[model samples]
Target: MTYFPKLLTICILACILGATTFFYVKKSVYIFDTNYFKINSVSRAALKETGSKQCKNCSEGVPNLIIQYGVGRTATTLQFQILCLMMAFLHEDEINDVGCYYNRRNLVKKYNVIKCHDISWYLTVKWSKWVFMTSNHALLSRRLNYMRGKIKDKNTTIPFIADIDLVSRRGHYIVHEYQRFFGISDEKMQHIVEYLRYWDVLRVCCGMQMSADWRNHLAPKAKYKQHHSYHSPTYPACEMYNISQVEHLLVNTYVFKKLSHIGSLRDVIGKTSTVDGILNGSYCERCNTNISKMHLKFNQNCA
Candidate 1:
């Protein structure tokens, strides 16, 4: 009887240990489903026909296919809406806001937009250009760990990795700093000032009279909070950031160290210019200049 009881106790302990190990490993890795990419018909066909993971003969005019891989808690929805509006203004079509996949109608379609959140999907797929959106580590961790009630861990815990190194060197990628969205401007610094002015007016007008869903999904009441459960059209203003926390994340994390290898916008475009300047928008020459001039015009309907 004693032996049996001891054996039973051992078995229970083993099971408990196994379960703990499983949960720990699972939490450490990013969890996603097969449909995460939602690869559309056009991309599916392209992959099948080419038997390669690269878009051939891509140029700057209108990308054959553009993948916007916005990191979680990184103002993805905001960027998506902004890009969609810009596309509409430019008369472009076939933008899928959910996942990074699109079907082109014809040659005149110019380009298609697909928002991809899966880092795994981004690493495996092929596309003409990638618009990578992310924020500093401090802000990303805070939002990811946000809960209305009690906290789980005493110290900061990062369940997923959003390092810049995951970006593939085989293709073209543009790392757009999320912080810049707040004070977005060009070399001259006028578009975003005007854009923010319009954004403020829309926020007030819709904030007072909008439906519950509209208010929750479109505009966040708090500056630090995200616009929606999923994505936001704009990041909180620069004033909302915790400067001390931002500095802490920068100094403590190795992720930001990888960015040092990436050349700043002012630096001569060379092999090291693997990505557009990530740490600050002031260093991002292309984004500050081209993006302002070529794209990003205000649209009334988005409100």
Candidate 2:
């Protein structure tokens, strides 16, 4: 009887060890799934085809497709919340495909938005001195700029609903920062100024809320000028503009269509719609000039 009990104990221990090893190995490996890329989804394929055709007029490269899958009905909202959570925990790394996949699968449904906001707030309170320092700001800005360039080049736009959530989160961060510094006195006015400043920073770093007229006009002209009457748009240029327009349309379809959304707005305006144009030139003359001045002022302040 004693021998049987000892054998049972050994077997149980072996099983426990085996299970732990399996989990450790599983956690260590990063796997990419076709579902993550929406490879088998019709919606993803269609979006890719449309995006590729549209981006061909731009000078930069674009992703062949923009894919959206679901973690449930609330996937978009959950995804945004998860992004905020990961940014809080992971410290803004390169955001590789594998990292994105793992983070999405692991965290999306596990945390609610309110929970995420609390965790993020806790992190900011505990780590703000380390995280939100001026030196870190430059690093964060560069990382965001790099990500923006990658998205622009791939011609892949994030989903509009998700973008809205990101904008909202950014706005919240701005207000939070103001409250930390300014307190409750004049809170309302400070909130508005902070919101505008937040948006301005987003426009500069994230390429949010772009005008479609720039893509329609400037992209084609840049293509033509670069290729010297290449006559028809090339694949890359077509893909870039297509992605750009679709992204812009997703955010503002009616506004995009009303702005003479056509081929090559730049030729008419006498300019080029390179990545710089897409980033800085897509706005109307007034907004563009204002953004430029703000950029100058920002640089001066940084200096």
Candidate 3:
């Protein structure tokens, strides 16, 4: 009789702990169903974290088709809204594609206008990006473990936008926006940030995918440049990066974009003249002086 009472007490404590954790996750984290998530066709009510149909198999190919952006201050809100609206263009199958596929469209609407999508669609994209990134079994398992099945899918793509935002500092702004849009308490917002940072969806490295740093390790410097296009809009900004030690391109995007402006380029281009000369000629040399003027001259000669 004495042993039975002790066993019953232990069982009751275990049940209480389990119940507490279940409810905690239920209130804390949310995951979305990327399969049905589209930015354009949104029903905010559909995005509840019901704990059913949460895990699915990821696509087999490498995720080489992701649309990356640094999310600048001037363009942060506008870019997010634009991408959310653009999600409507994504095919159902593409939602879970490891290649991170999504369609792009013209920025036709007035950016300043407040539409329902500004909030709902923004959250939808956030969830979708994370879902695609976590398509892998191990990473998906890790994500589920972290969220504790309390994840909110928003049934749209809210987690996705938040996932990409995790890869950059600008993600802070997006989190704040989420709080304002949803009336999330400050404590809840901070809790969400902690969870996203701890799991790090952006840094979910795998054999099929690695960042520019790993690529440099495996391939020659020249090959790395060629593979990623040194002419990328963010190229000039990347030039200042200590590529020898850099690990994550997604992480560096916002850093370089913020650090290297026209004025900053002037210092860089001028210093190049003192060395072997990266530009070979005066194109980048005078880049700081008049990029538009030099660009026109080069284009005219080519024509």
Give me the candidate number with maximum TM-score. Answer: 1
Q: Which digits, one per residue and each the tens of the lDDT, describe model 3 over residues 191-249?
A: 44442331122211111122344334333355334433455432223335433223233
TM-score of 3: 0.22
Model 3 bad stretches (over 4 Å): 1-169, 201-209, 218-222, 226-303
For candidate 1, lDDT tens digit of each residue in 72-184?
43434334434332332233123221111222222233444455555344333344433434333443345422420111222211112223222222111122222232222
Which run of 10 residues does model 3 get worst, by summed lDDT? 267-276
lDDT of each: 0.32, 0.30, 0.30
TM-score for each model: 0.27, 0.21, 0.22
RMSD of 1: 18.8
Task: List clash counts for every candidate, in order.
Answer: 2, 23, 26
